[model samples]
Target: MADKLKVALAIALVVAGVVGFYLLSEQALVLRVLSVLAGVAAAAAVASQSESGRRFVGFARESVTETKKVVWPSRKETVQTTGMVFAFVVVMAIFLWLTDKSLEWVMYDLILGWK
Candidate 1:
């Protein structure tokens, strides 16, 4: 029952937000204001739920903790890897272009007997 209520409320919030946005589309000022207002209301409603709210909080905390544990590459390593990737991409692009032009030339000049 609680889960159903939460789901229904979430759906209703989304529908309301969509409707509000559609209605406000004609008025730029109203659209901007209502957009922020609807977003805040939606957030507040989600946070108000007991079980769902606790889950959200836990999820956020776990995400932050996992992010902190990540081993980010050094600036020098990142730059070197980026350069290598770019070099490979450019080389592959040039190779493909040449192959395509050669195939086109063969088909039109030799096979089709076009000058």
Candidate 2:
């Protein structure tokens, strides 16, 4: 029940911020943007108090840690992979074009004799 309440409050805070931004239309752009940011920050703080929020935060941290451990491909490997993909695409395009023209020729010049 408390967690639900926290979530609801956080949502309300976000809505209030958006409303504030529109209501302060006469204000400067920076102030209006700040209003929205403040609302979002407050909502985050409120939501982070909930049980599920804590779990989400923990999961996010774990994701970041796991990402750090990943062995990403080097620049050379990336470029090579990209080049291979482009080559394959070009080859496939040429093959498809040839097949299409061949079919068109056979259908019009041979079978139907429309030419």
Best by lDDT: 2
**For residues 1-115, could you state the per-residue lDDT of candidate 1 as single tens digits?**
7866775776677677767777777778777577757865895576557577778878999999999999999999999999999999999999999999999999999999887
42-73, model 2: which lDDT tens digit per residue?
99999999998999999999999999999999
Worst 10 residues of 2 by lDDT: 51-60
Residue 43 shift from truth in candidate 2, angstroms: 0.5
lDDT of 1 at 56: 80
Output the worst ten-in-a-row residue range by lDDT, candidate 1.
Answer: 43-52
**Cα shift from native, residue 8, model 2 (Å):** 0.2
Query: How well does each candidate superpose onto the true structure, as a TM-score?
Result: 0.65, 0.97
Go through the candidates in order and give the C-alpha RMSD of each one to the true structure. Answer: 4.2, 0.7
TM-score of 2: 0.97
Q: What C-alpha lDDT, on a 0 to 100 scale, does residue 8 get in candidate 1?
A: 72
